[model samples]
Target: MMILGLVRWMQPVHGYDVRRELLSWGADKWANVQPGSIYHALRKLTEEGLIRAVATEQVGARPARTTYEVTPVGEDEFQTLLRGFWWGLSEPLDPFSAAFGFLPALPRSEAAAALRNRANLLRANVASMRASLESDWIRNSKPVHVGWMFELWAARAEAELSWCEQVADRVESGVSYLPAELENAEGWSAWREGGAPLDADPE
Candidate 1:
């Protein structure tokens, strides 16, 4: 999606230039761009008749480079990709699932505190990233709606904060995520027999 928009914004650009522009706009840090993927996408786009080479030029210190422009078909393809990107929604893919699965070991009060702390951290991050997202670098960029990406990010951050608060409340109220077996003695021996450890301390 970015490549399409970028090529449309700056036609007659090389893969390296695309990479450089993306880096300048901090796409690697914020978006799903990989520096190495630009050339590959360019090749694929050319093969798919989305973009066509227009000229070759040699700068003083840089190697000769082939420039590309979006074809008319590429404009249509770009809109397709852009619309698909904007309309698509996905569930959160958090990396903390594994740690959360083992979270029963902590006492309820401790867990609540930790969750609250996480909520605060996420709030701070949301605030900071929002400031940057609203900065000229993003707002002045193409599409005028680029800031919408960060707006969605902020919304997710707000959702996460709410989830953290809810989870903290649940932990504090003793309505934890622990399974019934972990909360009862009958579950222990059976769980042990199933080769899972009964070392879980549902404090």
Candidate 2:
């Protein structure tokens, strides 16, 4: 959907330009836009008849580059995807959420320390985002909505940081999870020793 939208917005654009534009917009960081997959995605979209190659240019000694423009079908699909995402509130899956389910497997001190480390990382990310949003280039050259994207990302990081800190504090000060006996079972001891992952449904 993102690639289709970008192609529609910047018609007659090359895959290199599209990839660069997405990276410039920090889409790779926030969205599922992988730099390596952009070219493949363009080819796939062309194959699917959603985008058509309008021109191919070759500079001597360099690979040929094809320019693309979205089709009417692509435009309609992009609009449908955009509207669906806007009207929905689906949350991205976080690995932390899955790990949190087995929180009792770790000692309280280790869990608290890990959460603190995560909080620190989030703090750094938030600071970097704020710095970018305040940069002269962002303010003068980028669209106003780009700043809003940074704000949204920073706000989410801040919220998660707060939650991490709160959880760390509670864990450090003692919060009930599983019964002590179960937590210290032979299986849990093996997991800690072997660093084994839990099954979706452990017997």
Candidate 3:
């Protein structure tokens, strides 16, 4: 959808320019639009009759560049995909959630230290995103909506950073590491076998 939208917005754009534009928007980081994948996607879209190659030219001593424009079908598809995403409630999966499920796998001290490390990383990421929002390129070259993307990212990172810090503090303070019965291998085996369900009533 991103590639189609970009092609529609910047018709007669070359693959190189497409890649550069997406990079400028930080799409590679947030949208998973890798630099190497843009050309492949362009080819695929062309093959699917969604985007058409309008021109191919070779600058002296440079590889031939193929320029593309979105087909009417591509425009329709792009709009559909965009609308679906806009109206959807999908959230990206967080690796930390999976790791946290097995928190007791590590020593309590180590687990707390790991979460603290994550908090530090989140802090750095938030700082970088905020700094990018204030950069001249973002402020001058891109449209106002582009800045909103960075704002959204910065906001999410900030929220995660706060949560990470609070959780790290709790872990460090040994809050609910586990019930005493569930701190050993036998307990874990029982839990896994459903001999002991975490949410089961004591009665």
Candidate 4:
């Protein structure tokens, strides 16, 4: 979305220049966009006829560079992608949710261990994110919205880290989960015996 909008707004920018602009704008920290992905997106958008190469220029010893300009179709697609992401209350479909749903397949001890490991990793990541936000590079270079984005990601990481600790404690303490039946046991007994998952009812 940012790529398309940038092309449209900037008008006939080279791939390298676009990426430099994006970096200056701190899209990596804010939009999670990598520099390589921006080039890929430009090539893909060109192939899709959303953006077109307008000119190729060779300046001095530098190799020929292609400058891209947005087409009418690109403008329409940009608007669609932009409008799709709105500020409103909506459930984000996270892949973590799926893994969490399937967590019962593992033994309680294994699950607790895994959750504790995850908590440790999240703690490290949250600390790194907070540090980056505080660093002069991000604080000075990024826009106010980019700062908000970092704050949001850091907050989410912290929350998830806390949840991991809580869930691990619950599993370790045996505070949650239903009474077990002979049909299902933790780890791979239920799967090996061709039954439902450990938490699932045979009925």
lDDT of 2 by residue, 40-157 (tens): 9999999999899999999998999999999988888889999999999998898999999878667678889999999999999999999998898578644568779888889999
Candidate ranking under lDDT, highest first, comes to: 2, 3, 4, 1
Candidate 4 worst ten-residue window by lDDT? 187-196
Against the hidden true structure, what lDDT does model 2 obtain? 0.84
For model 3, the local distance difference test gives: 0.80
Please list the C-alpha lDDT of all candidates, in the order they appear.
0.77, 0.84, 0.80, 0.79
TM-score of each: 0.72, 0.80, 0.81, 0.75
Best by TM-score: 3
- Poorly placed runs, candidate 3 (over 4 Å): 59-61, 177-203
Q: Rank by TM-score, descending?
A: 3, 2, 4, 1
Best-fitting candidate, scored by lDDT: 2
C-alpha RMSD values across all candidates: 4.8, 4.7, 5.4, 5.0
lDDT string for model 1 (83-199, tens) is 886799756667777667755556666778888999999999899778978688877775556577678778988998899999889777765354665645654543322223346
Model 4 segments more than 4 A misplaced: 24-34, 87-96, 179-203
Number of backbone collisions per candidate, in order? Answer: 0, 0, 0, 0
Relative to the unseen true structure, what is the C-alpha lDDT of residue 47 in candidate 4, on a scale of 0 to 100?
A: 98
RMSD (CA, Å), candidate 4 to true, equals: 5.0
